[model samples]
Target: MQKYLILLAGCPCTGKTYLVNQLQQQFKDSFVITPDEAKILYAESIGFNCKAEKEALEHKVWQFYYGVLQLYMDAGKRVIISEYPFSDKQKRQLSEFAEQYHYQVITIRLVADFDVIWQRRYQRDRSPERHLCHIMQHYHYGDTLENRNLADDLITKDQFYQVCQMRQYDQFVLGNLIQVDVTDFTKVDYSRLLNELKQIVKL
Candidate 1:
Protein backbone atom coordinates (compact mmCIF):
# COMPACT_ATOMS: atom_id res chain seq x y z
CA MET A 1 0.00 0.00 0.00
CA GLN A 2 1.42 3.41 -0.94
CA LYS A 3 1.61 5.84 1.98
CA TYR A 4 -0.21 9.15 1.80
CA LEU A 5 -0.46 12.28 3.96
CA ILE A 6 -3.86 13.82 3.42
CA LEU A 7 -4.17 17.32 4.82
CA LEU A 8 -7.64 18.82 5.21
CA ALA A 9 -7.41 22.61 5.58
CA GLY A 10 -10.16 25.20 5.95
CA CYS A 11 -11.81 27.73 8.17
CA PRO A 12 -14.08 26.71 11.02
CA CYS A 13 -17.54 25.38 10.09
CA THR A 14 -16.40 24.65 6.54
CA GLY A 15 -17.50 20.96 6.56
CA LYS A 16 -14.06 19.50 7.24
CA THR A 17 -15.42 17.19 9.89
CA TYR A 18 -18.05 15.83 7.51
CA LEU A 19 -15.38 15.21 4.88
CA VAL A 20 -13.23 13.49 7.47
CA ASN A 21 -16.02 11.03 8.13
CA GLN A 22 -16.52 10.46 4.43
CA LEU A 23 -12.82 9.85 3.88
CA GLN A 24 -12.65 7.49 6.84
CA GLN A 25 -15.46 5.41 5.38
CA GLN A 26 -13.96 5.50 1.90
CA PHE A 27 -10.49 4.53 3.07
CA LYS A 28 -10.99 2.11 5.93
CA ASP A 29 -7.37 1.36 6.83
CA SER A 30 -6.18 4.98 6.70
CA PHE A 31 -5.32 6.60 10.05
CA VAL A 32 -7.16 9.81 10.85
CA ILE A 33 -5.75 12.37 13.27
CA THR A 34 -8.11 15.01 14.55
CA PRO A 35 -6.40 17.70 16.65
CA ASP A 36 -9.48 18.52 18.67
CA GLU A 37 -9.78 14.90 19.79
CA ALA A 38 -6.06 14.87 20.48
CA LYS A 39 -6.37 17.97 22.62
CA ILE A 40 -9.21 16.47 24.64
CA LEU A 41 -7.36 13.23 25.27
CA TYR A 42 -4.07 14.93 26.09
CA ALA A 43 -5.80 17.29 28.51
CA GLU A 44 -7.39 14.35 30.28
CA SER A 45 -4.09 12.50 30.58
CA ILE A 46 -2.35 15.53 32.06
CA GLY A 47 -5.20 16.50 34.41
CA PHE A 48 -5.47 19.78 32.52
CA ASN A 49 -8.78 21.57 32.35
CA CYS A 50 -9.28 23.46 29.11
CA LYS A 51 -11.52 25.95 30.84
CA ALA A 52 -8.85 26.78 33.40
CA GLU A 53 -5.62 26.26 31.48
CA LYS A 54 -6.48 27.24 27.95
CA GLU A 55 -3.30 29.15 27.24
CA ALA A 56 -0.94 26.26 26.65
CA LEU A 57 -3.39 23.71 25.30
CA GLU A 58 -3.00 24.56 21.64
CA HIS A 59 0.81 24.47 21.79
CA LYS A 60 0.61 21.09 23.46
CA VAL A 61 -1.90 19.78 20.94
CA TRP A 62 0.29 20.73 17.95
CA GLN A 63 3.34 19.15 19.52
CA PHE A 64 1.54 15.90 20.13
CA TYR A 65 -0.18 16.03 16.75
CA TYR A 66 3.11 16.41 14.84
CA GLY A 67 4.75 13.63 16.82
CA VAL A 68 1.91 11.27 16.06
CA LEU A 69 1.96 12.24 12.40
CA GLN A 70 5.65 11.41 12.10
CA LEU A 71 5.21 8.10 13.87
CA TYR A 72 2.43 7.00 11.49
CA MET A 73 4.44 8.17 8.49
CA ASP A 74 7.47 6.24 9.68
CA ALA A 75 5.29 3.15 9.90
CA GLY A 76 4.29 3.72 6.24
CA LYS A 77 0.56 4.18 6.89
CA ARG A 78 -1.85 6.47 5.10
CA VAL A 79 -2.47 9.41 7.46
CA ILE A 80 -5.24 11.97 7.30
CA ILE A 81 -5.08 15.16 9.39
CA SER A 82 -8.52 16.64 9.56
CA GLU A 83 -9.44 20.33 9.54
CA TYR A 84 -6.18 22.06 10.38
CA PRO A 85 -5.45 25.58 9.24
CA PHE A 86 -1.74 25.09 8.78
CA SER A 87 0.51 28.12 8.97
CA ASP A 88 3.25 28.72 6.40
CA LYS A 89 5.88 27.43 8.79
CA GLN A 90 3.92 24.26 9.37
CA LYS A 91 3.44 23.76 5.66
CA ARG A 92 7.17 23.99 4.99
CA GLN A 93 7.86 21.55 7.82
CA LEU A 94 5.29 19.12 6.43
CA SER A 95 6.78 19.43 2.96
CA GLU A 96 10.22 18.54 4.22
CA PHE A 97 8.85 15.59 6.17
CA ALA A 98 6.86 14.29 3.19
CA GLU A 99 9.90 14.51 0.92
CA GLN A 100 12.07 12.72 3.45
CA TYR A 101 9.57 9.88 3.86
CA HIS A 102 8.56 9.63 0.19
CA TYR A 103 4.89 10.07 1.08
CA GLN A 104 2.43 11.50 -1.42
CA VAL A 105 0.82 14.63 -0.01
CA ILE A 106 -2.73 15.65 -0.86
CA THR A 107 -4.28 18.85 0.41
CA ILE A 108 -8.05 19.37 0.34
CA ARG A 109 -9.18 22.88 1.10
CA LEU A 110 -12.86 23.48 1.88
CA VAL A 111 -14.27 26.95 1.40
CA ALA A 112 -17.65 28.67 1.74
CA ASP A 113 -19.12 32.13 1.83
CA PHE A 114 -18.89 34.01 5.12
CA ASP A 115 -22.66 34.01 5.54
CA VAL A 116 -22.91 30.29 5.03
CA ILE A 117 -20.00 29.66 7.34
CA TRP A 118 -21.59 31.80 10.06
CA GLN A 119 -24.90 30.01 9.72
CA ARG A 120 -23.20 26.64 10.09
CA ARG A 121 -21.28 27.90 13.11
CA TYR A 122 -24.43 29.31 14.67
CA GLN A 123 -26.21 25.99 14.38
CA ARG A 124 -23.22 24.12 15.71
CA ASP A 125 -23.03 26.38 18.75
CA ARG A 126 -26.62 25.55 19.66
CA SER A 127 -26.23 21.86 19.01
CA PRO A 128 -25.63 19.57 21.97
CA GLU A 129 -23.09 17.60 19.99
CA ARG A 130 -20.46 20.34 20.28
CA HIS A 131 -17.85 19.60 22.89
CA LEU A 132 -17.69 21.74 26.03
CA CYS A 133 -14.03 22.63 25.61
CA HIS A 134 -14.74 24.12 22.21
CA ILE A 135 -17.67 26.10 23.54
CA MET A 136 -15.68 27.47 26.45
CA GLN A 137 -12.84 28.60 24.20
CA HIS A 138 -14.76 29.91 21.24
CA TYR A 139 -18.09 31.04 22.66
CA HIS A 140 -17.19 32.25 26.09
CA TYR A 141 -17.69 35.93 26.70
CA GLY A 142 -18.27 37.78 29.94
CA ASP A 143 -20.26 34.88 31.37
CA THR A 144 -18.62 32.36 33.64
CA LEU A 145 -17.81 29.10 31.90
CA GLU A 146 -19.71 27.09 34.49
CA ASN A 147 -22.90 29.12 34.06
CA ARG A 148 -22.68 29.68 30.31
CA ASN A 149 -25.32 28.21 27.99
CA LEU A 150 -25.60 27.91 24.23
CA ALA A 151 -28.31 30.52 23.92
CA ASP A 152 -25.79 33.02 22.63
CA ASP A 153 -22.45 32.88 20.84
CA LEU A 154 -21.97 36.56 20.19
CA ILE A 155 -18.27 37.02 20.84
CA THR A 156 -17.01 34.12 18.83
CA LYS A 157 -19.31 34.97 15.96
CA ASP A 158 -17.86 38.44 15.59
CA GLN A 159 -14.31 37.23 16.06
CA PHE A 160 -14.72 34.40 13.61
CA TYR A 161 -16.20 36.66 10.97
CA GLN A 162 -13.35 39.10 11.28
CA VAL A 163 -10.78 36.35 11.14
CA CYS A 164 -12.39 34.73 8.15
CA GLN A 165 -12.66 38.04 6.40
CA MET A 166 -8.92 38.36 6.79
CA ARG A 167 -8.53 34.71 5.78
CA GLN A 168 -6.65 33.71 8.90
CA TYR A 169 -8.02 30.20 8.78
CA ASP A 170 -6.94 29.62 5.22
CA GLN A 171 -3.75 27.61 4.89
CA PHE A 172 -0.95 27.85 2.39
CA VAL A 173 -1.42 25.88 -0.85
CA LEU A 174 0.48 22.60 -0.87
CA GLY A 175 0.94 19.48 -2.97
CA ASN A 176 -1.96 18.28 -5.14
CA LEU A 177 -4.36 20.97 -4.03
CA ILE A 178 -8.10 20.31 -4.41
CA GLN A 179 -10.31 23.22 -3.53
CA VAL A 180 -13.93 22.32 -2.76
CA ASP A 181 -16.75 24.82 -2.60
CA VAL A 182 -18.99 23.89 0.30
CA THR A 183 -21.32 26.88 0.49
CA ASP A 184 -24.21 24.45 0.43
CA PHE A 185 -23.59 21.03 1.87
CA THR A 186 -26.62 19.50 0.19
CA LYS A 187 -25.28 20.47 -3.21
CA VAL A 188 -21.72 19.22 -2.70
CA ASP A 189 -21.04 16.33 -5.07
CA TYR A 190 -19.31 13.81 -2.84
CA SER A 191 -19.13 11.15 -5.54
CA ARG A 192 -17.30 13.47 -7.90
CA LEU A 193 -14.99 14.57 -5.11
CA LEU A 194 -14.13 10.98 -4.22
CA ASN A 195 -13.46 10.18 -7.87
CA GLU A 196 -11.17 13.18 -8.24
CA LEU A 197 -9.27 12.22 -5.10
CA LYS A 198 -8.97 8.61 -6.24
CA GLN A 199 -7.39 9.71 -9.49
CA ILE A 200 -4.70 11.72 -7.70
CA VAL A 201 -3.98 9.27 -4.90
CA LYS A 202 -4.59 6.23 -7.09
CA LEU A 203 -6.59 4.65 -4.27
Candidate 2:
Protein backbone atom coordinates (compact mmCIF):
# COMPACT_ATOMS: atom_id res chain seq x y z
CA MET A 1 0.00 0.00 0.00
CA GLN A 2 1.26 3.48 -0.81
CA LYS A 3 1.39 5.75 2.21
CA TYR A 4 1.46 9.55 2.33
CA LEU A 5 3.47 12.15 4.25
CA ILE A 6 1.60 15.40 4.87
CA LEU A 7 3.58 18.36 6.21
CA LEU A 8 2.03 21.54 7.55
CA ALA A 9 4.11 24.71 8.01
CA GLY A 10 2.96 27.97 9.56
CA CYS A 11 3.82 30.62 12.09
CA PRO A 12 2.20 31.00 15.52
CA CYS A 13 -1.61 31.18 15.69
CA THR A 14 -2.12 30.57 11.97
CA GLY A 15 -4.52 27.60 12.47
CA LYS A 16 -2.20 24.73 11.59
CA THR A 17 -3.53 22.81 14.58
CA TYR A 18 -7.11 23.34 13.45
CA LEU A 19 -6.38 22.03 9.95
CA VAL A 20 -4.58 19.00 11.39
CA ASN A 21 -7.55 18.20 13.61
CA GLN A 22 -9.87 18.35 10.63
CA LEU A 23 -7.58 16.15 8.57
CA GLN A 24 -7.36 13.61 11.38
CA GLN A 25 -11.13 13.43 11.52
CA GLN A 26 -11.20 12.83 7.77
CA PHE A 27 -8.34 10.35 7.75
CA LYS A 28 -8.77 8.48 10.99
CA ASP A 29 -5.92 6.04 10.40
CA SER A 30 -3.35 8.75 9.66
CA PHE A 31 -0.81 9.55 12.40
CA VAL A 32 -0.69 13.19 13.55
CA ILE A 33 2.41 14.56 15.29
CA THR A 34 3.19 17.96 16.78
CA PRO A 35 6.14 19.18 18.84
CA ASP A 36 4.05 20.94 21.46
CA GLU A 37 2.14 17.76 22.29
CA ALA A 38 5.37 15.79 22.33
CA LYS A 39 6.95 18.29 24.72
CA ILE A 40 3.94 18.09 27.02
CA LEU A 41 4.05 14.30 27.15
CA TYR A 42 7.77 14.24 27.86
CA ALA A 43 7.49 16.88 30.58
CA GLU A 44 4.63 15.04 32.23
CA SER A 45 6.59 11.81 32.13
CA ILE A 46 9.45 13.49 34.05
CA GLY A 47 7.08 15.15 36.59
CA PHE A 48 6.87 18.53 34.81
CA ASN A 49 9.81 20.66 36.00
CA CYS A 50 11.44 21.75 32.74
CA LYS A 51 12.39 25.40 33.20
CA ALA A 52 16.03 24.87 34.17
CA GLU A 53 16.25 21.92 31.83
CA LYS A 54 15.08 23.60 28.62
CA GLU A 55 17.98 22.51 26.42
CA ALA A 56 17.99 18.95 27.78
CA LEU A 57 14.23 18.67 27.53
CA GLU A 58 14.20 20.02 23.96
CA HIS A 59 16.87 17.52 22.94
CA LYS A 60 14.89 14.61 24.35
CA VAL A 61 11.60 15.86 22.93
CA TRP A 62 12.91 16.14 19.33
CA GLN A 63 14.64 12.77 19.61
CA PHE A 64 11.32 11.28 20.61
CA TYR A 65 9.50 13.27 17.92
CA TYR A 66 11.61 12.00 15.00
CA GLY A 67 11.73 8.56 16.53
CA VAL A 68 7.96 8.34 16.45
CA LEU A 69 7.89 9.63 12.87
CA GLN A 70 10.31 6.93 11.82
CA LEU A 71 8.23 4.28 13.55
CA TYR A 72 5.06 5.29 11.68
CA MET A 73 6.88 5.52 8.35
CA ASP A 74 8.44 2.11 8.84
CA ALA A 75 4.97 0.75 9.48
CA GLY A 76 3.68 2.36 6.24
CA LYS A 77 1.19 4.55 8.01
CA ARG A 78 -0.02 7.86 6.56
CA VAL A 79 1.59 10.65 8.59
CA ILE A 80 0.85 14.34 9.09
CA ILE A 81 3.50 16.45 10.83
CA SER A 82 3.05 20.09 11.88
CA GLU A 83 5.81 22.60 12.49
CA TYR A 84 5.67 26.20 13.71
CA PRO A 85 8.33 27.27 11.26
CA PHE A 86 9.69 24.51 9.08
CA SER A 87 13.37 25.19 8.58
CA ASP A 88 15.23 24.47 5.34
CA LYS A 89 17.12 21.58 6.94
CA GLN A 90 13.91 20.00 8.19
CA LYS A 91 12.32 20.30 4.74
CA ARG A 92 15.28 18.48 3.23
CA GLN A 93 15.03 15.80 5.92
CA LEU A 94 11.36 15.21 5.12
CA SER A 95 12.13 15.01 1.42
CA GLU A 96 14.68 12.29 2.11
CA PHE A 97 12.21 10.39 4.28
CA ALA A 98 9.57 10.49 1.55
CA GLU A 99 12.06 9.16 -1.00
CA GLN A 100 13.22 6.36 1.28
CA TYR A 101 9.72 5.33 2.29
CA HIS A 102 8.21 5.66 -1.20
CA TYR A 103 5.48 7.87 0.16
CA GLN A 104 3.77 10.69 -1.70
CA VAL A 105 4.33 14.06 -0.03
CA ILE A 106 2.07 17.10 0.27
CA THR A 107 3.25 20.25 2.03
CA ILE A 108 0.64 22.76 3.16
CA ARG A 109 1.58 26.29 4.21
CA LEU A 110 -0.88 28.30 6.29
CA VAL A 111 -0.76 32.10 6.56
CA ALA A 112 -2.63 34.89 8.31
CA ASP A 113 -2.47 38.66 8.74
CA PHE A 114 -0.15 39.78 11.51
CA ASP A 115 -2.86 41.65 13.36
CA VAL A 116 -5.11 38.62 13.27
CA ILE A 117 -2.29 36.44 14.49
CA TRP A 118 -1.44 38.82 17.28
CA GLN A 119 -5.04 38.95 18.50
CA ARG A 120 -5.30 35.18 18.44
CA ARG A 121 -2.02 34.85 20.29
CA TYR A 122 -3.13 37.30 22.91
CA GLN A 123 -6.28 35.32 23.63
CA ARG A 124 -4.51 31.97 23.60
CA ASP A 125 -1.82 33.18 26.00
CA ARG A 126 -4.43 34.38 28.45
CA SER A 127 -6.45 31.20 28.25
CA PRO A 128 -5.98 28.79 31.18
CA GLU A 129 -5.96 25.90 28.75
CA ARG A 130 -2.59 26.96 27.31
CA HIS A 131 0.03 24.23 27.72
CA LEU A 132 2.59 24.48 30.51
CA CYS A 133 5.63 23.91 28.32
CA HIS A 134 4.74 26.88 26.11
CA ILE A 135 4.52 29.01 29.25
CA MET A 136 7.85 27.72 30.57
CA GLN A 137 9.52 28.42 27.22
CA HIS A 138 8.99 32.15 27.71
CA TYR A 139 8.27 32.94 31.36
CA HIS A 140 9.30 31.42 34.69
CA TYR A 141 8.37 27.85 35.53
CA GLY A 142 5.40 28.75 37.74
CA ASP A 143 4.07 31.56 35.60
CA THR A 144 0.64 30.67 34.24
CA LEU A 145 -0.03 33.82 32.25
CA GLU A 146 1.84 34.22 28.97
CA ASN A 147 1.42 38.01 28.76
CA ARG A 148 2.17 38.86 32.35
CA ASN A 149 5.72 40.06 31.69
CA LEU A 150 6.45 42.16 28.62
CA ALA A 151 10.20 41.60 28.94
CA ASP A 152 9.68 37.86 28.68
CA ASP A 153 7.81 37.94 25.40
CA LEU A 154 7.65 34.56 23.75
CA ILE A 155 8.41 35.90 20.25
CA THR A 156 8.35 39.63 19.93
CA LYS A 157 6.03 41.33 17.46
CA ASP A 158 8.98 42.61 15.47
CA GLN A 159 10.49 39.17 15.22
CA PHE A 160 7.18 37.72 14.11
CA TYR A 161 6.78 40.51 11.53
CA GLN A 162 10.19 39.76 10.07
CA VAL A 163 9.45 36.05 9.87
CA CYS A 164 6.14 36.62 8.12
CA GLN A 165 7.48 39.30 5.80
CA MET A 166 10.45 37.18 4.86
CA ARG A 167 8.14 34.23 4.12
CA GLN A 168 9.97 31.92 6.49
CA TYR A 169 7.27 29.26 6.70
CA ASP A 170 6.44 29.68 3.04
CA GLN A 171 8.77 27.14 1.52
CA PHE A 172 8.31 23.50 2.51
CA VAL A 173 7.37 22.64 -1.08
CA LEU A 174 8.92 19.22 -1.47
CA GLY A 175 5.80 17.95 -3.21
CA ASN A 176 2.50 19.62 -4.04
CA LEU A 177 2.27 23.13 -2.59
CA ILE A 178 -1.01 24.10 -0.96
CA GLN A 179 -1.09 27.64 0.41
CA VAL A 180 -3.95 28.48 2.75
CA ASP A 181 -4.92 31.94 3.93
CA VAL A 182 -6.33 31.39 7.39
CA THR A 183 -6.90 34.99 8.48
CA ASP A 184 -10.51 33.97 8.99
CA PHE A 185 -10.93 30.42 10.18
CA THR A 186 -14.64 30.36 9.53
CA LYS A 187 -14.08 31.26 5.91
CA VAL A 188 -11.74 28.35 5.31
CA ASP A 189 -13.22 25.61 3.16
CA TYR A 190 -11.74 22.58 4.85
CA SER A 191 -13.86 20.12 2.90
CA ARG A 192 -12.59 21.52 -0.37
CA LEU A 193 -9.03 21.46 0.92
CA LEU A 194 -9.40 17.86 2.05
CA ASN A 195 -10.86 16.84 -1.29
CA GLU A 196 -7.98 18.51 -3.10
CA LEU A 197 -5.49 16.62 -0.93
CA LYS A 198 -7.39 13.40 -1.53
CA GLN A 199 -6.89 13.84 -5.22
CA ILE A 200 -3.13 14.07 -4.68
CA VAL A 201 -2.69 11.26 -2.13
CA LYS A 202 -4.97 8.38 -1.29
CA LEU A 203 -6.66 9.21 2.04
Point to the candidate with the largest lDDT: 1
Task: Report the lDDT tens digits of candidate 1 across residue range 157-186.
Answer: 788778765755664567888888889889
So what's the TM-score on candidate 1? 0.83
Query: Which residue pairs come into collision in candidate 2?
Result: none
Candidate 2 to truth, TM: 0.83
lDDT of 2 by residue, 64-162 (tens): 877887778888886555555675757766777788888887788888887999888777765667765565543333445545443233566677678
| TM-score of every model versus the real structure | 0.83, 0.83
Query: What residue pairs clash in candidate 1, if any at all?
Result: none
